[model samples]
Target chain A: MRIVIAEDAAVIRDGLSLLLTTRGHQVAAAVGDATALCAAVAEYGPDVAVVDVRMPPTHTDEGLRAAIRLRRDHPGLGVLVFSQHIETRYAAQLLAEGSHGVGYLLKDRVSEVGDFLNTLVRIAAGETVLDPEVVTQIMGASRRTEALRTLTARERAVLAMMAEGRSNSAIATALSLSYGSVEKHVTQIFTKLGLPPSQSDHRRVLAVLRYLES
Target chain B: MSFRVLLAAPARKRAWYELGYALVSLPIAAVGLIYLLVMLLTAATAATFVGVPMLAAGVLGARALGAVDRGVARALLGVEVPVPPPFRPRPGLIGWLGSALGDGAGWRAAAYRLGKPPVAVLASGTAASLWGSGLVLLSCPIWWRIPALAHLPVNTWPRALLAGTAGAVLLLLAPWTVRAALLPDRLLVRALLGPTRASARIHELETTRAQAVDDSATALRRIERDLHDGTQARLVALAMSLSMLKDELAETGRDDRLDQARVLVDLAHRNAREALVELRDLVRGIHPAVLDEGLETALATLAATSSLPVDLQVDLPRRPSAAVETIAYFCTAELLANAARHGGARQAGIELRTRNRLLRLRVRDDGAGGAAMGLGTGLRGLADRVRVVDGTLKISSPPGGPTVVTVELPLHP
Candidate 1:
């Protein structure tokens, strides 16, 4: 994997560079602010770019805007927005252009190194990935609460994982269940929530997220 | 008494100013008295068509003269009186006539002008006679040596000696007489020339409200910067270090790297602890935990850790409201810090007392005493904070000694 990192904090930026490089991933460029992030991504054409939502010169949404612009300018390049906070409006804006090749996760998720790396790889593979915190927030505030309430606890868990853009195998591993039973829970969630059952991980994410948002 | 002490009135500039003010008032008063009499005569027939406009013109003229008198008092008497609000007459003739006729400040000025002539005459007469007689008699011995006055009977040695002694006595009394004569004019000018009480209060609140807003904004920005650059960054670093440690541990069969992983764990632990400490300080900056235990305890805690030795005394009949308590606490904190930093003080004192439903906090320091408001030393900011609650801040810091700052807040604000 080839990557570019943009974070204002020098410690986090260097740690990320070291973490990816030691894991056999190429860190093409590691910059500190949004403008340099743009220039680096354009120069390196890395497969995926990890960007912090708060960067220099106002430290308020420059990274989010830069990521949005980068996605527009380079359709094939993937973007994973990493931030200390989960602003629901930011998630909505990032997911507005169809949830492919995009990821949004909290800065704390980096402590779970394997999970963080898996999210990055999924993003690079043209898959949508969302932090569980973001998914939980969306579920809490979802307009389809009546439909959501019809599902059992296990089926709701499957739906939340699906909204987080997890494949059945990943959901099965996280829930300590067999892949076949995870598939059964996914089918039950679809029927209960009145969503069309989708087989592929990418389609499943889109359907679940769209249903929750609507 | 020494002759120099007796003649001190002539040597001092204040005596001359009083004499000058008294001399000028006579002519100014004569003109003013004539105009006032005519205005009074016109006011008697106010039922007529032209009576109201004439009265308005007369009142406006008196207001102009009042401005002149205020300037004279400020320049000669060193009296500071704030400028009054102007006549806010509406547009069109009838609107203008109504407002002008009803203008309170104009009527007050007219009354001042009407009552000035008698006091001016008395003041000028006393100043002239006292200073004149004193100087002439004091110089009798010297002018007696002149050939023109040598043959005069009063020029004899004993008579001259008597005149000189009387002159010395009169000279000693001149300053007091002049000050006494000018007192009425000063009172009349101050009472009539300055802004009305309500207007002055409103203007003061407007100014302090702006300063309070700016102070709060600056404080919020500082907090944001602290969290962003301190605690948040520290936590992120701690997490990154822990993640690195986890990765190192996950790699098996590496005995040499075990020590490195242990070192990483130690570093992460230190970062986590430091982050917690930074967060605690930030929380305290927002609102101290000790405040919940009541203001007295909070102040005691503050005084205990002050850079300079602080003597804390709190005497409250009852507790002030939370808002007043917060203002009082922050005011004491800032003042104590200032006493240590800019004041370069050896010791400080904080005294809190509540009387007549007002909370008063007095902070004093035995330091170089030139602390002042509007000097960008946080004193002005503290004053603004106090005034936001309709409170007051007073500073009595004479050069070369102790600086004392007093802040008073309403107990129910």
Candidate 2:
């Protein structure tokens, strides 16, 4: 697999390059900030681009903005965002674009090893992998809205993972149900929550998720 | 015939009008001061001996001299003295004394007291010669009747001159002398018991602002520290892993070794991503972007997962200072966390209002009912924050479930 890394910190960039190189996946470019990241992604044309949420000048949401723009500019380009905080705003935006290959999680997930690489693999395979903590904050926000409260506890849980912009398989695995069962639960949740009567899919869930987030 | 008739008229009617002014003003002023001192003592719990009697005196004397003071004020200063509120005691003796202490009748009474001595001495000494001459001049009309006494006293012109001199001296000195007489008494009353109300509202703002500054600084530092130590570390690890993966790939082409290297590379990627999340958390801690949308939107962001229901009552028409709003937001977040973490409360309430040109922000909870402030460092920091704005944070957690923390900040732009 070919990957392009976008992180301002040198240690992380170098370490990620070394790790990828050893894995036989070429890290064609390890760029310093998100601007450099986008340029690198454009030039190298990697299979997946991992960008940090905060980068160089005015270390605010520069990285998040860059990730959003990169995905917007180059459609179908797999992009994963790394954030130190519980920020689902940019992640939701990314998922809203169509939840393919979007990863949002805490940095601590890296030390967990299995979860971190699993999320990475999932992202590479074009699946949305969201951090549990990030999902918790999202669920916390959605639960407060009138639109979300109408769902029962069980249905609400299903909606929460869906709002994470998860795939049907991911939702099933998360809720410990079959893929078909998860799909059924999601439909019931959408109906109960009074979301759009039609257009129930990953994008719709992401749309509703983003709506409840703000 | 007319002159002789006027001279013969009854003296009683003339006498009543002559001394009317003098009898009124001085007496009333004296009574007011005495009443004021007594009331002060009573409020301090010393009025048992002083206040009761003064109240009695003020009631009787103030009424008696009321008309007189009016006549004097009108005659001397041309200022009318309406019949003031009657010397009514509070519903009870204690309340009455408190009211007296609170009102400003003390200095007026004292002025009438101390202001008389020097005034009398000067006026009397200066007018003694004039009065003596007055006796001589007044005798002129009777001089011829007295025969020897009238004829020997002086010529008509001299008598006329003497009368003029006497009256002139009295008239010139009277105005100044009377005004001087009340100076000491007025000063005494003003300083002793004049209204001494200090504004509680102003004092409260000062205390609250001071606390607010402290809390903002502490919060900012905590966030910076969290970022410096937390996410910075992960990014560094990511860099190191990238370095290792590059070197391992160059040395070995085996599938298993490459797979192990792949794992490390993935770890670095995840580490870097997590670092970004930490950085975002730090950003939110500093200023939640939702605040830019508005305070309501920001609050919506906060309610994501509060343990108990947060009843909000914020009805502000205008926005407060950025510092104040930020402090308020953090204060709410901290309080909710506190309630959830410590307060076994079932519900909480938040209210916003303005009073005395202050932004009033309050948060309360219905928990174990015994919520005291010493419970957490978070509140201490909050207290410090409100202080920074020269505002105040009062925590009422009396070992029960319902604990309330109220903050007040200056609303001035």
Candidate 3:
């Protein structure tokens, strides 16, 4: 995998580069701030860019905005926004157009090396990935919506995992259910929410997000 | 007591200003008396409904006159009086009349106008007589040959010299008379035209409160930056180094000292993770980043994270000043925390609305009650904090199962 890292903190930037390099992924470029992140991504066209939310100049959501622009300019390139905190508004905005090839995760997730690497790989494959915390917060915000009230506890759990951009099998494994049962729950959620079933995981995630956000 | 004061430059300038001020006051006083009479007549006939608008207009006119008086005092007497808050009439004619009639400042100004005539008479009367008589008597010797003063009383040289000496004495006493006469007018203007003592205190409190609020906000930002750049950065680096070390030890496949080194690294990594969590929480407590979005979003986020189920509602005509919003946000945050920690609440509700130029936040909870302002530092601190902006926090909780807290704040600080 080829990657570019955009972070203001020198320690984190250096550590990220070293970690990805040691894992045999190519580090094409690493820059600080949003403008340079855009320039590097445009130049290198890396498979994935790990960007921080707070960067130089006005260190408030600069990287998130830059990632939004990158998603517009280079649809194929993946952007995984890393921030110290999770804001649902920012998450909603990043997923405004679509959830495909985009990810928003907290910086603390980096310490969990295996999970973070999996998320990077999943994002590079044009899959939608969100931090579990982000999913939890979104669910909390939308818990009062009429559409969400019909789901059973187990079904709601399945919905949460799905919202985190998990595959059917991954949901089954995480929830300790068989593949057939996960499929059934997913169908039930889609039918109950009045969403047309789709073959693509990206569309399924986008539909679920649109429902929750609405 | 100093004789030099009679000849001092400042005293001489002040004496001239006092004389001019006294002279100008009489005409102002006459106009003020007319305004006063009109106001009183309109107020007396207020039951006929013809006086309402008249009374409002009269009050407004007096305020205008007061403003001019304030300017005069400032220019001549070097006394600065701050302008009070403007009269904001509500919608409709009745509302306008009510606000105008209820304006304490305007009424005080009218009273000042009505009261000025007597003060002006005394001041201008004494000053004019002293200066006029002194000049006339001093020039009597020169004008003695004139027919106006051609009497037998001043026909000899000694009498003429005696009249001239008396004139000199009178002239020497004129400045003192003028100074004494103007003192009461100065005092009256300071008391009437300036802000009332209570309003002045409020103004001072408002200024200091704004300063305190801004200072805390800046300090919180600094702390967050320091943690972000110093402790959190170093901890992340340490964790990364340990992870690398653990990987290296595993790769080396050495039996000797490998287990010990791995255990130490694992402990260090765990501590690093814990430190990061604590630091994140500290930063959030100092100032939530979500607050930048606005109070509604920030409160929603707070509700989402609360241990108790929270139902939040926010209705605002517009955003308040940043300092005001920040103070309100912290108050809500502390109250919610208190509800969970001390009250053992299962459900909580927060409602924010603006009415009558006031921002009101009501927080209710279904919990074991008996909450008092002095029971905990949280409530006490919040009360003090809100008081900075002339806001009030009221708590009503008996030894029961429900508690309600309401905070009222000015829309702008």
* Tens digit of per-residue lDDT, candidate 1, span A1-214: 9999999888788888888988899999999999999999989999999999878797667899999999999998999998765655678789887777999987767766767888899999999998887788777656566687888899888888988889999999999999999988887887778788778787787788778766
* Tens digit per residue, CA lDDT, model 1, B1-413: 77666568666888788889999999999988898999999998778988988988888878888899899999999999998876766546897788888877788888888778888988999988988898888888888778987787766878988898888788779877888988998988888888789877876876676566556645665665667656666676676668667666766666767867766676775666456456646655665534545789778766755656788999987877666777888898898888878877888999998866678899999999998888877988888778777789999999886999988887764
Off by over 4 Å in 3: A143-156, A168-199, B1-12, B40-67, B78-115, B147-165, B191-199, B254-256, B296-319, B327-388, B391-408
Chain A: TM-score in each model: 0.97, 0.78, 0.94
Give the clashing residue pairs of candidate 1, or none: none
Q: State which candidate has the highest DockQ.
A: 3
Model 2 CA lDDT for position B310: 74
Instruction: Assign candidate 3 its CAPRI class.
Output: acceptable
Which candidate order results from sorting by DockQ in descending order? 3, 1, 2
Task: Grade the docking of candidate 2.
Answer: incorrect
Alpha-carbon local distance difference test for all models: 0.81, 0.61, 0.82
DockQ each candidate and list the results.
Answer: 0.18, 0.16, 0.36
What is the TM-score of each predicted model, taking all chains together?
0.55, 0.48, 0.78
- State which candidate has the highest TM-score: 3
User: Stretches of candidate 1 above 4 Å error?
Assistant: A199-203, B1-78, B82-182, B190-217, B254-413
Between 1 and 2, whose DockQ is larger?
Answer: 1
Of models 1 and 3, which has the larger TM-score? Answer: 3
